[model samples]
Target: GLKSSHFITPTPIQALAIPPSLARRDVLGSASTGSGKTLAFLVPMLERLYLLKWGPLDGLGAVVISPTRELAVQTFNQLRDVGKYHNFSAGLVIGGKPLKEERDRLSRMNILIATPGRLLQHLDSTVGFESAGVKVLILDEADRLLDLGFLPALRAIVSHFSPGGPNAQNDRQTLLFSATQSQDLAALAKLSLHEPLYINCNKPGEEGVVPAGLEQYYAVVGLEKKLDVLWGFVKSHLKMKGVVFVTSGKQVRFIFETFRRLHPGLPVLHLHGKQKQATRLTIFQRFSSSKSALLICTDVAARGLDFPSVDWVVQLDCPEDVDTYIHRVGRTARYQSQGKALLFLCPSEEEGMLQRWKDKGLEVKKIKIKQSKVGSLHQQMQNFAFKEPEIKYLGQRAFISYMRSVHLQKDKTIFKLSELPAEEFAASMGLPGAPQIKLFETSKANKSRGGVKQPEVEVDVASEEDEDHENVAAQSKVSGPSLKSVRTKYDRMFERKNQSILTPHYNSLIRHSSSASESEEEVFTLTRRDHDLPEFGGSTSGKSRKPLISSEDLSKRKLKAGGSKKGLLKIRSGPDKVIFDESGHPTTFYEAGKEAEDIARDSKLREKYLDEEKERMRKAHEIDREVARDKKRERKRKRKEKEKEVSKGFFFLSYLPPPPQPPPSPLFIQKWAFQFKVFP
Candidate 1:
């Protein structure tokens, strides 16, 4: 199978990791992406099972865990291709499939390729799904598995198949592999590996951890110009297949939608977390199979998935760390193939992120963007946004998402919001002005990491298929933590201070919108205090903390002349508030009895007041009309008097015209005498 599929030689990671893995020794491997890491462990898993004379009756021999569904799918496909000569029943156990169906067949799967949440579900709930004889425990992208997010599920899953279990897979040989391996030995310790060997392909004083054939370059562009540089690069490399990574899904949609409308001479596709599993799979297949295409997506596509013949990797903003940087660039330059990566760093992000890359022993060359090559998209973006309101809305969302992502960054030195040219960035996105990010500035967006397709209210801009997917996304739920609370973007958008939109216009946009499951949204208040606040100084001992600026002290604080940026922007109506009650706080309809009566009384009084004002205005308008008529008559009379005076002067000049013929006497007499003589 390997020879038929053109897998000729073993990469460094495969050579090192395979040997230790086959020797029944635990192995923790770190290798650059696209270095045949998938095959490294699969070979050993197949060999071990073959050596043991394993069969279907053995009951779940091997379990491969990946951080993402795309990666899990990729691993399952690779396993099928290479392990075809051997008899092993492998099944992909990820979300988006019918849980009951998966459970029915899951008990029969000898080897399972799964994500953490779904696998844990089966381990805890599925009947007859035994892991007693599970021999090999492999975690692909182990760094992500060790992240704070996936840690809980990983711990729970590991607890199910530990060595002390009654039918444990004989000391459970474990293999952990990632492009960037986790450094925390304590976390790895929880996985119960017996004296794991760390196999890293990186050599001291060698060309960095990234693929040697990959050429890396970066440019110090201001926040506003990053998009321009990216657009220029894309336009220049229209024939080259590439992936452009942005910070968030909103940004991915904005770039893809707007750029596709602009017609960049290539097929453009977008992949983000909010998309449905089917839509994501379809897009993944499309991009993978295309002869030449460009993919604009968030970090969702950064890990283990492979793309053939990829030529370029463009990163719009600095990634959170070196690991992400490696994964993003690793998409290209596979197995000695040459590729290029371009990084766009803002003026504020350049120093910190550059030094970070350098500390990781990476030598990224600095390059200047040729002003001649950079195509100006400001006017084009502005025109589209100004005319097409859909484009305008998307631009606003993209800007907001970028700001919030930067604000939420753990490192302030690399992502300082104050130093960024936000207004310029807004303009570059084609917005007339920047939206007020007061909500993000003071309070974190507190976006829910789980549940609800989160298609994130990233309105499907153009495609009907994408629109359908987005509608399903609003109701679809995932298990980052649980299905109990899904943080959808519905509430965050309502709270955003979009100064560009009029009250009625904006209301109409969201008036008909619906959500199947309403996620918990951020709330603002003057009295309630949170421990995460900086003023509290990180004390969590149940000690009573003081509110720095309360309603009473608000008048005392010398606030700036304009509106204050300190207070909460959106607040849920409290019990004490008179204007509203908690029976579904006011939308287009008022549910509270008191509020309804109050509105009715106010309406009557307002109608009477309007009638009186109308009467007064009518009387005043009549007087003004009469004054204007008198002014017009007086001007007509003045014009008549001036014309009469001019006519009288003209008549006098005509009456005196006969006295003006005395100048030609001599010439006239001589001419008359000559005429008489000549006639005789």
Candidate 2:
């Protein structure tokens, strides 16, 4: 039932390696990016796995380990597709996900795709894989796995399948794949292979072959000018669907922000190591499935992750080494398809690296770019001279939101719009909606006609700026105040105006906020009105009525006297909200000093407890030292006593030696001995 098209169109790596691989040969594949290396081995491996179908009792028959979660997930997806018609179930086990879920899924999977760390964790635990009837072990990105210091773990895992040993195997198959093979990989190959049929896809003197269907180009510029060059490339090469490789997450965010600020419609995604697993998966899925493709990422994304239709791979940062250079460009021209690889290099550093690459037999063709060759957006920015920033179609706020999102952040605005009700928008903006419009300050001449409070009047949209200026000026022109006081007042007024305009936007963007303060009165009342009323009636039902204070009254009291009892009443009446100081301390305007004292007291108590604990530890150490000294002395005394006893026994034996001098030998010998003894 296999399609003829699939077989005939096998990629170069596949064509050269698949047959030998199927015949159970050891293959050394040196294919570049976009080579059909995945399928080349996957097909043969799957065929072997299918042949070894050990029934439902056998959980999995094959294992694949990849460097990254994204790559692992991607490989798992591809494997799932290939195994679909074959009725084989595949499971994923990667970091940042529950191991138990993976363990449960393993029960149903016929194959396991996992990251190194998580896989090792599962193996060390009660989760046994012997029942899975695992017949093959594949280390995809074999070089990367070794580079990540997974050798000990990998050896431990391999030790489990030593035939006729504790974790014995029933005839095994081993496949190792990498974009580039190093010495460590060779050592690992020995451990995995038992006289494998060796095949090398990249022959000597073919370093820059680039899969025959790939085009490569390089641009030389200053380090400072690389971002500008990238922007130009992106604008001109809109047709290309691919990734931009950067050196750091910061750079990923920087490129993302730059492009987003230039063009809002560009659907660009940023992928990096620091992002949450779910977020990275969503980004990967979106880019993989959609046509509007431009992914900006680090070299962590350079290999084992496949995107079949990718038309370009732009290296925004110069490669770390020759192998990295190969891996970065290999992202394009994958799977036997035609693609392009572009490298943006700094002028100062290009010569040495270029020569090194050439010595390695790589021809990095240089491409020229002039200012005249700049794209539309860059051209416009270059030509237009202005003091203020140009007001473009995309609003400042929207552009900033996009920029933040590109930092691989979930844009608060996007989340806000998705999660909130429309009515909350007006309140978020600090303005009442149309139906609830209580006061209007539109006509300055007719301010007295509507019976609205003069000081509490809201400015109309057309005159809001004028009102802000007037208020700022008035606040600044304090006659009976010190210069510092006037400056403070002026700053406070300006800050208030700016916040009043921007708070709604901020509130709208926040997915979670102070519900007690931000929610509407109706929401607040509904949530608490009945709940606060007790089933058992309180005694204060008919107490003296509290005076209803106006907003103006509270403000006037605060200005006249910094703190008053009535101000406390006003604060208590308002919704609960935290007031933080410059140092991020929780404090109230009235109780700041007392709160500071309480904080100091708590800190002192904590230090005192720690000191006590340290003292106790010091005493315990002294006691241990005394005990050890006593034990040492006791051992020394016992040794001395034993030595004394041994010495006494030897001394007594020496004194009794000669045993009466051979029983006086003979009568004449005794007489001669007496004469000799007397002379001695």
TM-scores of the candidates in the order shown:
0.64, 0.53
Residue-level lDDT tens digits of model 1 in 146-262: 553676687788788857322444768888887775556447655557677878787664322888899999999888988788888888988999999999998998899889988
Report lDDT per candidate.
0.77, 0.63
Q: Quote the positional error of residue 461 for candidate 1 in Å.
A: 28
Q: lDDT tens digits, residues 1-680, model 2?
A: 13632444766678887787676555666666666677877788789877776555666677888888988987877776666677677778887877677776666777778887887787777355553356767788888887657777787777765432124456666777777767887788887776665555675776534556778788876543555666777777776687898766755654565566567355889998888899999998888887757899986788767765888888876665677777777776665578788887655446667776776677778889988655434333322212223322112332233222222212222122222232332222112231121122222322323333323223122234566645644543442122232233334344553655655575454345466455655555744121222111223245533334333444554445435556444444444455887789886665876765675679787687789999999999999999999999999999898777666655554454353644755675546544434222
Against the true structure, whose lDDT is highest?
A: 1
User: In model 1, how large is the Cα lDDT of residue 655?
Assistant: 54
Q: Following a full C-alpha superposition, what root-mean-square deviation does model 1 have from the true structure? A: 26.6
**Stretches > 4 Å off in candidate 1:** 164-169, 205-208, 438-680
